[model samples]
Target: MALASLAAASLPTAAAAVRSRVSLLRRAMAASPSSSSCAGLAGSPARVGVVQMTSVGDLDANYATCSRLTKEAASAGVKFLCFPEVFSFIGSKDGESIKIAEPLDGPIMQRYRSLAKESSMWLSLGGFQEKGPDDSHQYNTHVLIDDSGEIRSSYRKIHLFDVDVPGNMVYKESRFTTAGDTVVAVDSPFGRLGLTVCYDLRFPELYQCLRFKHQAQVLLVPSAFTKVTGEAHWEILLCARAIETQCYVIAAAQAGKHNEKRESYGDSIIIDPWGTVIARLPDRLSTGFAVADIDLSKVEAVRTKMPISEHRKFDSDWKTS
Candidate 1:
């Protein structure tokens, strides 16, 4: 089947790329709005919260942490909540993720839907391993649930993390997962949101398309950054994306040590267009959350001042070899 046909037929169930399920949910909601239960949350300034999880191989433990943190964020008047990558379970080894992969209509997604509805908040799951038919592949997916508990928008991690970082940090996402070909963004009360996952951060062009083409005012980057790179590049890169694009960036990260001898740098943050960190979690346990208010006016103000979008000069000599 063609890639579009395959994607249309079923939710992208490729485990390595995060946010595929959310992308699927977005398409579904767009196709049939009545099927979704969540209502749109509207306002110029959006109160956003993020959940950071130091997920282990245990599903129960991860779910409990998400539930608790979500409740806390809701109590704090957070209307939009985002979670870290692999919020359900981060396995100890490769292939171990397949064991925990569930279908889109399974218990895991259902739980998230219920949570969004009960809290009366728009929710975004960073990424999950969703089981596909025949169980051959699992999608690394993100999902957005509206305040009314209806699924809103979703995106698969288009840029697979298939590179070899020095010091033995090697990831071959294409080995077990499929790549997403399309970029996705969604409209909400907060503004247009560009959805992406961990590895996608390295590609600035994707953000350019999202910002310039889709008019995305906010970008959501849910990550499980490794210690080696996160310490050096995580914050800086995130800030740069926000500054360059003049958009709000919300990055909910996985922190602390996991059972597989892997340590994640946990510094989940919300950055404004001016590249200011509004909220962050102090280093501690592997699980927690942060909340911040996003003002769309700031995005407009920055864009108006810089006007980078309007001033574009392309040299004929510019070429890619």
Candidate 2:
């Protein structure tokens, strides 16, 4: 089914940039005399930020960009900061990435953890390359760091990118990486968060398991989506997931042309429960970050009105046990 059918009917207009939407929200919040008067809410809004980068093969350049943007988010009072897929390095060729692949406890992970602690914000590293025990294989993984700088959880990209898109857009991630067999979600101060990497976003079942089975309140998609496909379906699919699951969606994207040949569509966005673009960064840049105060109460209010969770219909024909 087309993903747009599952979402609200609001295509973002040119006038509705992230900054303007946020400014309007702040004004509304200020205008309300009491927090209870707005949305009949119970808790304070959580501040979330996303970092979008135009990462290339240079490790130093990528690290510098991450460092600068993450610090900027922290200074702006973001409680949680997230990066894009393969934030460390995206090489010119496939096997070339193996050169930069490090262990889970390597310098790259350590640096990110230290940064999380220093900034006093929860950090989600999009996806990194980790060298497996053998020399022939690696794992595409996302690492979550708590505010205390501890590695809270890690999720490997379960659904590998093994597609042959027309016009030379062929990528067989299984060529160098092994697939993960598990779904992962972690608990955070703001809410429960489901974590997934680039290609995993296409699989709605994975997200269903995260939302329905695991009870995730937020979904994180750290991706380096290709320009060819992202333009056609990125925002629609993200909003669909948010509206259908009643969860906040934060997608940190790798935007702009990377090398002489590779290009990525960078329109990093944070969508609220009502399928609204609360925050977004520009399409091209070395360093850009967006912050939004997500009111968790909206999740409860939406779900209370439409109790899809309790009204689930089981498919007896598709029963497995």
Best by lDDT: 2
The digit string of per-residue lDDT tens for model 2 on 132-177 reads 5567678899989988899999988876776665554667788889
Clashes counted in candidate 2 amount to: 1
All models, RMSD in angstroms? 9.6, 12.0
**Model 1 Cα lDDT, one tens digit per residue, 137-189:** 67778787888888787777777666555564566776766665567778887
What RMSD value applies to candidate 2?
12.0
Highest TM-score against the true fold, candidate? 2
Model 1 off-target regions past 4 Å? Answer: 1-44, 132-134, 284-286, 314-321
C-alpha lDDT of all candidate models, in order:
0.74, 0.77
Clashes of each: 26, 1
